[model samples]
Target: MKIKICFLLLLFAFSNSFGQQNNFNYKREIIGTNDQWHKLELPNEIFGKISPNLNDIRIIGISEQNDTLEAPYIIHSTEDQIKNVNVDFKLLNQSRDKNGYYFTFKVPTSNSINQIQLNFEQENFDWKTTLEGSQDQQNWYTLVEDYRILSINNAHTNYQFSKLNFPNANYGFYRIGIKSGEKPKLESAALFLKEIVKGKSRNYQIKKINTIENKKRKQTELDIDLGSPVLINNLKVNILESFDYYRPVHIQYVTDSTKTELGWKYNYQTLASGTLNSIEKNEFKFSNTVAQHVKIIIKNSDNEALTISNVEIGGSVYELLVRFSKPAKYFLYYGNTNARRPNYDISRFSDNIPKSITTLALGDEKIITKSETPKSEPLFADEKWLWAVMALIILILGGFTLKMIKKTDEREV
Candidate 1:
């Protein structure tokens, strides 16, 4: 009897584990050729259904023999790829003129350079700059004119935009003119060729926007709602005013929500924080985040609030690089709460991935029906059978307890 009870308990636990492992809420067929490797871009609809970490996603392939196999995949996000090549240069001279300050750099290789990054010791300064390039110091051609470089260092914000970007120009010597009242303290400078590979992205529509100004806190808050939860990583806050202004901006997204008698309460987590200035584009990027509601808080301090024209939010599209062993029909399954992150060899050796592969499309999503029966039926196939098993176990335990009590009563008498 003891062995039977222990066996029943173990069976119950095993059944639960089996169900959790195989149960997935939704699936979509992969509409592509049975290539050795394929890439599938995840649609926006899956963002709301899958886990935030995306551990629940799986690719199941059915072979011609009707055997199911799990395929390993790597999630790839289309984020901007940047490559920079530093050009060795020497500072030929630094002088102050009636205009302001000027610095000359001589490049030995005379490589084609597009960007110059400057570092300064002074914390707070706004300066306009002009860049000129020439093979000889005497003959100079203007590269960038009247470009603004700004830095604001205070208790509330630390921001700088001192990088000068221009078209690729090859010259033996380069001179920079800074327009400032006093001699600007120069720290360091770097000349490099920057190559940016823009990634594929999708912009999300903002369903609603609400603004609130808090005079007491000296802050302006904007509440933005994207109708449904989607993956986002980029935001652009457009300011309408042309006047120069700088403010520290805090970005957050709703993680969870609760409903109460008052209203719906939202819990938010920080996504990114940066300074918003008139000199730069005011665009911010962070890790891909799944959110439906976002909040932006701007620290105005004593400065007047700037008018917001509009806000743009977007994220890089996610793709799955999957390897298929044999020609098989595959289906993408997700929405399993108890799923664990899979470890595969391809994840460790990502360099083996092909440079180019066919991108597969997804078919219409279908919900997995719970009423579908498995190939092999269990002892407790129905709810009534499970209840009956539980009742039998209880009766056997009760009988043993009564027997023990009766034996003890007889001995006492």
Candidate 2:
């Protein structure tokens, strides 16, 4: 493996030396930290810049084309292993939702409940409810009221949600209510608090949010540009006013549509307004979905624009698989101006190919500990020195061109 890495490095160096004036520069990147070997797609731009006209290009650690020409992506010999996380959730309560199901659950005085899981079997209809906590069952106080639980299974939309989280409260008894539904079967559900051993890696953060506040006449609108398509998880809307109220926040992504009969069509999704009774922050969290541009229409409800301050949008952390034998120097490279994104499946293992792979029981899902954004490094392999050399060469060439042009002009005179 050492021999292969050295050979690939030499080949890449050779290509770089003879590359175009712009040159093909490789750089270090920190994309993800996963236990399995993540087969990644090289930045398409790399393919166009390198030895063009060739039938194929080589990536180290990836391709083993020829014994003489090794791939640039190959690692320095590493053992491959997988990290199995034992993830299992517990069942809370399973009952039919006929004419709105409401039940009282028990919570110990010591332990705090953070997550509420639900599994629905019925296909049609939307259910909304809330939770109330109290020391005694007779005297109850609303914890989170008018909360919605939707289970949609249709051609356009298909969703099965079983988890609802809230700020942990120390309460002896908790009430669960299901509103606006009759005879909704309980498929299977579990309430679990994730507990796992921490790994020695950082989280991967890949998002760039550009926020613009537009104070409308009776409402607040924001046209947010997320630099690129990202799987956004949530956004926090900052309301500066002291008064707390619930107003629906509508979100719509820039859909690819020329024009419809009624006019330009927009695919809009909405989050029901939550009860905001404090001066603190109120958050709107969405499921994992890819969106490049987002437009937010904040319902003012007579709430002035002066009350709004700012909004914060955050994307979900992405994980990639990498198989390393030992601690070796690795780099994350991307931004191939012109190249085809390679195709490879990371989930499939050559050895353990399940014959009947229809069923899969996944455990609790949590953020795998890994580095985010990447350590302070340039986008490409460190190539600032190459720029200096190119500048000097360009200066010499420019001077030579000037001398020739002067001779021609002097002859004409």
Give the range where candidate 1 is weakest over 10 consecutive residues by summed lDDT: 372-381
After superposition on all CA atoms, what RMSD does each candidate show versus the true structure?
6.0, 17.0
Model 2 misplaced stretches (Cα beyond 4 Å) = 1-217, 224-232, 252-281, 287-294, 301-303, 324-333, 336-346, 350-413
TM-score to true structure, per model: 0.85, 0.37
Instruction: Estimate candidate 2's RMSD in Å.
Output: 17.0
- Best model number under lDDT: 1
lDDT of 1 by residue, 1-413 (tens): 66457757876895674476457888888988567888999999989998899999988866667665778999999978889999999999999878989999999995799999999999999899999999978999999999999888877778889999999999999999999997888899999999889999999989999999999999999999999999999999999989888798999999999999999999989999988888889999899999999999999999999999999999989999999887777789898777888899899989999999999889999987654222123443355665676678768867777897899899999
**Per-structure clash totals for the candidates:** 0, 28
Q: Which ten residues in a row have the lowest lDDT in candidate 2?
A: 70-79
Candidate 2 residue-wise lDDT at 373: 20
